[model samples]
Target: MTANASPRRWLFVLTILVGSFLLFLVQPMVARMVLPKLGGAPAVWNSAMLVYQALLLGGYAYAHWLGRFQIRRQAAIHVALLVAAALWLPIGIANIAPPAPGQEALWVPLLLIASIGPVFFVVAAQAPLMQRWFAADTRAGDPYILYAASNLGSFAGLISYPALVEPALPLAAQSWGWTAGYALLVALVAISAAARWRAGGEAVGAEAVADGEARPALRRQIHWLLIAAVPSGLMLSTTTHLTTDIVAMPLLWVLPLGLYLLSFVIAFSTMDRLVQTITVVAPAGLLSVGGLSLLSSGGGSMMIALSSLAMLFLVATALHGYLYHLRPAPRYLTLFYLIMSAGGVLGGLFAALFAPLVFDWVYEHPLLVLASAMLLPLPALFPWDQWLGLKPRAARWTAALLVAVAAFACWKMVDGWTGVVADVKWWGIVIFAIGLLVIGWRWAFVPVFALLMLGVGGWDTVQESFSGMRVRSYFGVYTVTDDPEHQQRRLAHGTTLHGLQRTEAGKQLEPTTYYGHQSGVGLTLDKAEALAGPDAAVGIVGLGAGTLACYRKPGQKWTIFEIDPVMVDIARDPTKFTFLSECAGDTPVILGDARLQVANQPPGRFDILVIDAFSSDAIPLHLLTKEAIGIYARAMKPDGILLIHISNRFFNLEPVLAAEAKARGWSAAIRIDPSPTGDDFSDLTGSNWVALTAAPQRMDALTGGIRPRKDSRNEGVWVPLEGRARFERWTDDYASTLPILFWGNIIGDRE
Candidate 1:
């Protein structure tokens, strides 16, 4: 090792870059491989993130402990640990299931840890520890640039998962490929460790003198945790909101996370001027568009789009930059990173683990926004800092009155739960005017600007989003909407349209929306007489708006299996969808998981069962498992058929159905009905329906009466999904939302 900067600097950069790249690359690749086994849902990604964060924190802690040793000892321990972790190589989860049934929430995390835990923990600590080693081995260079290289590697990995690894390889092949990369990573670590070892005996680098023997303050440590946690949690929350409420397209989730990673790149880079500029603008960004935190409102709001992206990038960069500024000396570098990693893990726990149980919907987004505002220092608009002299009492009162008026204006501005308001069209003019008048006082500016955002976009129809008028479950958000003649109820998870129904005078039960006459559900029910004769037994899984109830004929037994009680409550309320009242007035809606309930039902219980259980982006893996299919097969009569609704924003699930059927020796074919373009509402929705049947006679009977349109083909390769046979059967025993996230192509094709 020489003092010359040329070769050594390049070597340092290359090592950091490669290590970081491999670290981030594995995160998405492994996640994609586990999708089918886990279940494709947003919450699954959140869980996987938690695992990554937690492992990262652990790795940092390990690094911190190792750093306390001599240079040779540190290198020796790292080499040994890396080799030890490699023993569990070939990078795949263990073939293990939960000990008891119905414990997926608990078991998924444990399975994930058992599978990839050791491998990830070792790799995660490398960035911080390696940079410290570089600093200690070569005492002349600034290690901050290595941080930039590390993030650059991370950015590459995140980008590569969707663009290269997933599309290019299958799940099994991906595991082997990642294993090879892990081997290469081991070699790279060896090289770095060798470099450190060669740096002469007793390379004890400089140590900080203790002015006071006290350890770091508890408040500082908590602040570090908060700073890292807020942005990381918000990044996930933003992705959840955008995918579910804003736009449910492919690459949408990656965009927010990519930007989040990009923030770290900018924050840690040597370009101080750029960071300074962005930080200066971050406050204005937070105040201007921070109000529209609703997932229902899409990201096209000028203020929101700009401010949200800006605030996220700026605040994230600022906080990360602060972490870099307060970076511990080389002696304690791992400790600093350990604290940062812990913060990241905590953030994920709050967003993915705690929020779902606590808040009915995603509250992490607004909470993050408020946190960003507090962390960013504001510029003084007036020379006088005095609260009293800032603005006159009468003027302050007038401002409050104006805000109240604006709140009224906001109430009027909201067009629908789904669409943005018109007031945002003139938001710049409004915010600018308010900004001019409320310059000096923090309270005056913050509240009024927030009010203006509310009037323009934020508070519009918020009462509905909050008043339980909408229901967000593991499935998606269910809302009741009204038009001129017909009142409609819709369920959307991400951009994928799940289920919907219409009502006459907002109470008369009618099978509208996708289940209308034009839909396959409607067609099947319309010919119920020929299929099963009068008084046939019928079953529907998802009770959204209870539209399927309208298809019940006199003397027919109509049974529904609905998961969320909130949905049942909404449909049962006269103000919501009254399919139960207008259709099957006396029928009972069964509560609990549909598969569990149906699996336990007696044989020959139903002539037909329609599965419409998905909400938002969550596809219940348990319901689709092979064992569950056996239950469905047993529950229905020999002549009965099952209709599965596969319309989703982010996955190509037809293959899953096909594979399951193939494994069971049952037959399955898909039907694609295009949504009609008109104001009828009943005919204006698209659907992908897969009909499964064991008996050929029943299959023919089901599809014979309806006209067959050309089937829309999914271009991706269809692997045989022998559900739970190839992997852990998601049962009451064990399930996970950790690995089943395929955020690709949320919307398939235009109707």
Candidate 2:
């Protein structure tokens, strides 16, 4: 910037940075606050994400609409809107009633919009609006550079929440801190408004153009829309693909989004050489890392995850850099942003809304990966024209030949993986060699990428997705597969195994998977009659294949509570798995969030209450809160045993439960059934179960009355649960997955 402009320049940059920071910080903060109300389903996060995208589009449109007014008039209106939005100070979830069973689809958006809609809309407009105002002088030296600073602030806010803010302070503190930031933004906006106080300041660049400037051509404008949408859709799709398909790592959801926001920072920055380098390398990333990351995450789940992330960053930066290359002058700045935001919303809709409804698996990830190949700026890796010098007709024929080769290579690759081809490894090399040759040709590159995808594991993913064996619900995607060799059928939520049952005649009656005979819940189920009398009234939350139903006695009255109706269907269908049909065929399955539904159960109704409602590796923070403990305590008989199955690969949930149990003075015991081994290992598995009871003797009975560890080695030995130090007591107001994360366990070769 010129020496005359430093003061004004820094102020405008700071204001945009601050506003952008607040705009992103509110997302995780408010989403954390609402978990208690909505339960910790991954869909809740997806819904919240879609709502934010829609709101952002609205904010950008609002900014574009303001271009019609003079600078002072625009400033006055924005400031007034900011002040009025202050009524939603210390932002959090709204006070409205929680959604009914199937109404969460409607309720989550309503709740989010009602909570922070006004404040978010006002702050979200700051980046584009403030940039436009800064350009009022025409000497502000390319107002577009501030967009880099805006996304930088956005990246910082998103990363800092999980790393610095949430771990350091609770949700309430995060919210009030954001509110304070908003107040400062209001003052900053007023100061920016005062910087240029010329009444009827002919709108910046309102004067006649330099004979060549007008709106971007219709095709160019549409290019901007599509260019913006691919990365936006890929962001969410990549998150789902990595977490659910590759590795069910808790809190990994934030990485894709963080990289996405940072891409704009890199792309829009003044570092032209860096942008040029990423653009050049991105096509290779699409060819090498993109489809390969999805084909088969075989020996390297971690490597696959890292490569996929690298691919996302490279592709996003390259596409967005090209967007910067096509940018218009400052006159149509807000229009450009409006179209960009609209595209973001559309992409978000495709990934978040469209995929879940239309496909059973995360095809959007691979589909967008293909779409990236189509939209990415193609620069020749080598002198294709000089090297080949082929005529147009020859080129077309060669392209057709390449298409056939790609299809054959992909098919062979799949055959190799399935043992149909003798040299699978050679097939991969051939596909890679052919793909590398066509990196500069968009038409040729796409077919290679698509075929290469199927050659890897994309073919299997496609088969499974469309086989009608997978089901999508508000909660998650569940797939039921028959394991004939193991004589069992398995149910899976993402890569995490939900449950499996023996398909054989006699063994089908056994409770397998996490509820093996020696498991804590298994032992408690066996001795429940001794502890709570014969015909014990039992309630089980999370009906995963109804594996625990076999633990029910002839006279025991067992009730199952399941949140997802799709899961219920899978469990109840005898054709899928017979655990529910054979054991609890007549049992009633209550639907809704386990916590809310448990709250409505008649007092002292259950003699043995079990909380087992986990979906894959992600544990529900809301279910383990003290308030939820109170609900569980009220729903069970005074001396009844409360069993919780904390079988999560992503979290060490003992601390959350240990803290609540300590506070309530409940007797809690921890049991570890180390994942089973030998032939039964595939069906029966180890589980971490915590048994708590208000009555000490009941705990003693569950623990074998001061049991000795001298029992059979295969059986789990109950030990007193020790409270973890310096742990947060999760509540409706505050809960974070950072504390209890099994960071090392995030990557593994699991089914």
Candidate 3:
């Protein structure tokens, strides 16, 4: 409050802001750097998040311990820790090779921890520690408000990475930029330390008097932990749901995280009215948007994604605002953050580490939604006590039973909606019932809401579980479902159909989905046999039900490089689809990432190489980088062709591959395959494929009389990579999908 202390207070705020910014910025930067090595699975980012949360807990604990010491001693110890952490500076990942087969899950966490552990841990303590240090100065105002500044920096950092930092700087430059920022943070810390030293022993004695206040009870602390845990778990779950099920775009991960941090900013800001308003409306937002998220099933994906994000922000703002309400005095600031961080670690552990192992579907998403509902401050909508004064317990139990029955009836009714009109009517009825429950009885509201959510999606998951139709692994969830009407079995990875097989006795060898015989890869295979004879050596990158294996002829040497063992199992099993068993029987399947595996192969071994490893709509960007292209070129003969399955619902990848082809002096052509009409042995879907060959004559032979067209939407024609302004040559050190993201009306409506 004094004029002399004003400058020191601002200094502490600046230090905390800069430290928090660097803390969040490094998360995406380092994750991007390691993405290629880890096979670019979305789970890799989740694992990285778990490590960050665990380290944050460690940092908060350390800060709480430091709070026990005098201001001068605390400053000295923190300064030493910062200096020690600087030894791992420049911030690039350690020069370690990619993990071998079956080692990615263990290696990803270890790599992230070893690469950024010390620096991250040291910086993670800055917010609480700096607040504690400022609190020691009795003249400084309430230190809780400074938390708003910290998270604002975090929000800025997360958004900046995807929007500005990634587009402007390569990975190495990003690392060095972070290192420079770290150095600036150290300087700021030093200035704060000097200010504390100048305050002398009087300030320390004043701090001891303030620290003698009554401590929060154990029960209150546990409440704080639970309050914090729900939002933390919800943040990760939202990220997983959007990226895995809705859109597999890499930068989409930042939206939920940025909003989660922004919630802290809103909760702790000076704008109390705004926070209060959001808290008031939070319940309605959770029910409406959360219900929609649960009901979402490959339709209105953009709306579903936006709704899920809105739900996360609202739930987080309400919970964090409640945490703000329960915040202890300045003396207990570090302890408060310590408990909150511990809760965060628990939430992250459950979502990122435990959920996949325990659940067959993304059950964590709905379960966390229900938990958030329980934690939220609910309003009493009806006077139940007045209505049933004599036997209130019996009345409540009877009401609960009735609500359950109503929910079951609604579920059965909705399940019978096989027509669009019937579906619309059922949704209208469900919404009307939800509105009644919101006003009729508070106790029954959450249970009914939970039941509706279960009815929409949870019941489907239970069915899948009972039927053993789904399996969840670290890579993703795979579902095997049958369409008895069409006599077809399909393998789906998330929302994208990986492969489809006809159930007729002799039709098992047919190729479906993106691998139909008329597809680009198919045409390329035909040309390969014509050019290199019947015994041409071929390699396939992604094995999805081994659909492309049907194109293999006798005496043709075929090999497969697959990153996920689960996919390999599905493809190899005779009872599954039999594409591999009937076509390329006992084929040699190399287990590892294609980028690494292909590099290990002999030079000029394959006549053609096929890269078909897209999961859902997400293209593992690592496989499309320039270095990956080089590996493919090395493994192919001089005139060999490289076929990349660039079909995507969210991204237009032709430009990216075109740029790479232009840079590498390879001739490239694209084909957009048409979807098959009517029922047949093969259920062909629309697909996009790109073929690149180092030899122009080979490209010419494949293209023949077909002129290269400019329009990408045209079907079954070789498209030329004419317009190059939007394309950037992707490399291991630099790649951005923002430019090529599909901006059409059909944004999230992927087939």
Candidate 4:
């Protein structure tokens, strides 16, 4: 049973691939399953990521410690651990109830750790452990190449979950599929262990490899940690940037993470040419695209999103290629991975936890980009010593001049001293090109790059800082902007405009934006008295600048439910947006998730219930599920109307609502309001709203004269649920946005 004759190498590779695939696959799958329970906030995903990173670090440490034992003993212990962990399989979160209000941060991680901790720990260790086993058993090649295979499997799993798995399979099927994969991985591990045992504990280089190489120094280890830390932090920052600023969808999460893993695949592969090419071009990608993204305040959001993703991939590739170049010998493989995982944890902590508390903006994104530039390999562009005598003094003077210029530029831009220069986008491009050429000089490159980031985007940060216009919370970033030209003020969440108001003192009570007097929600409110009688009791799910409050009548009892406390504060403060104070003063506002809060209310209490809760373009899936609809139904009077604000940039949710309404035996009417025209002071924007009621007469009365015509998609206007057979009714057990995503309109929508 010599090493050369044994087939254990392939066995080990298969085991690593299967284990790593399941490891990354379960991440998004379980997170998606728990999204409803956790209220669909992006912070829940971040917290879940932290838990995974911490567990991965622990798993790596365990592998490194187990390296002290003989191969036979190590295999036995790991197999036993895997077997014990399998008891928690058919992987699903245990019936740990949703956390109490305000406890989501603590409880999300607690529940994840309790549900999948043991299983995740075992699978996480497979990569490093199997690689070590290969190093001990074979004398053929470096064992580290197998790491590329592991990441390849990881990339495949992540991409497939969103593109293939999620769209095709429900949660129950995905869970069982993952369980089957885990079982196969266990069998592969057993076979690999038996192969090692058959080698009679005298495989090639078992002792020699361990004693052959010197341990990496503390300085070198720290360098490895820093290199690994940059990409890890950058990955999370990129995810936040896209989801928070562009679109808050789960599909967006997979893009950055999949690219991040793919970088490892490309960097660690046998393709030396590809790695070298990327390493050469990465700095330019960061300088041009990354710098522009930071500086520009407004552009086509899809273009910005694509550019940002490209920048992330290029930067990650260069950083990871450098890491591969610095790899230690096979003897220190587990130790190397352990230190790298530790850096990953620190990076996750900084982006997900620290940045929100320390900075009012998404400052981490540009900061990490700058850090990536600093760490990139600086190849010499010209021979400075030969051309200019005495290189040291010339370098020192050059560095000082660049720093001074960068500082002066930032000062001028931030202080509004550069009036016309700031308006020209080409000026920033020229400066970025100069910065790219200076990468040969470390001192010059870092400062020049930092300056470009500040000059392009620094003024907005300065404006926000001085005016206190931006607020970051667990939900996302909210900015209050005053448009002097339009004589209006707006509250925006990410790229989506939440609410707007006329700036004139007397017009502050008028509703604007999507809630204008003639919009879908507006028309529904206008007819509320006719549909539900005088003095109707109303409930609103989302409190966006409190615009809906303007629709309240004198004797109406209106209540609003909001999840983020920061939003509640902004809406209630009269100086910010006066819709709440000017109209519905002293109205009761509940601070919690809408579904949960509405469920606890007295049954049959409200004449109308409005569902306006959304994060950017994301429809909170939890709110639209059948169970959630049931809860809303229980809280409403028998003939009460349900006004659902389904206007979104990335989803056509009318079909979804129609399907759900059909299942509940409720008649529905959809109103697609035309955009306002010709000096209309209402500031109305086009909107789509669906009204559901058990009483058909009420729907007919509310939708008077707004005949629903069949659209190009053959989707009829005000048609019964039978025409929506292509759409599935979402429930607590299953839902997928794949079928309804507005792919053709992604570029036009500022989601």
Per-candidate local distance difference test: 0.65, 0.82, 0.80, 0.79
Residues 1-751 of candidate 2: C-alpha lDDT, one tens digit per residue? 4657533888889999999988888898888888777777667888898889888989999999997889888988999999999999988778998666568789989999999999899899989998888878745567788899999999888888888887777777888888889999999999998986663333444332442577799999999999999999998888877767677666677889889988999888889999899998888888887766455235337777888888999999999999998888777889999999988998999998888888777777888998999999888676454578988677667767777887887777877686854577778778877777777778888888888877877777777766788887756668888878878787877766788878788778887878877888888888888887888999999888888888877888988988787888888888887778887789999987899889999999999999987766667778888788899999999998888988776788888888888888988888888876687466777788888988998887678654444534324678766567887787766667777877667655443
Q: Which prediction has more favorable lDDT, 2 or 4?
A: 2
**Best candidate, TM-score:** 2
If scored against the real structure, what TM-score would every candidate get?
0.77, 0.94, 0.92, 0.93
Could you tell me how far off, in angstroms, the CA of residue 150 lies in candidate 4 after the best superposition?
1.0
* lDDT string, candidate 3, 1-751, tens digits: 5766454677888998999999989998888888766666656777888889989999999999988878788889999999999999988778667677668778888889889999999999999988877766766767788899999889888888988999888998998899999999999998888877755322422324455568899999999999998899888888877766776654576788889999999899878898887876777777776764554354535777787899899889989999998998777888899999998888888888899889877778888888877887665344454555737676667667657675765566467534455664576456536534453355676777676676555555566687766788877888888888888999877776778888877876777777777889888886667868889999999898888888888778988998788888888778777888878877899987788789899999999999987776666788999988998999999999999987776778878888988888888888887777776624888888888999998888887844657564667788775547756689999998778777773454444
Residue 572 of model 3 has an lDDT of 79
TM-score of decoy 4: 0.93
Worst 10 residues of 2 by lDDT: 199-208
* Candidate 2 lDDT (Cα, 0 to 1): 0.82
Candidate numbers sorted by lDDT from highest down: 2, 3, 4, 1
Q: Is candidate 1 or candidate 2 better by lDDT?
A: 2
lDDT of 1 by residue, 142-257 (tens): 56667788888888988887777755565567778778887777787777777767564223233332323345577877777778888888787776665455554445567677
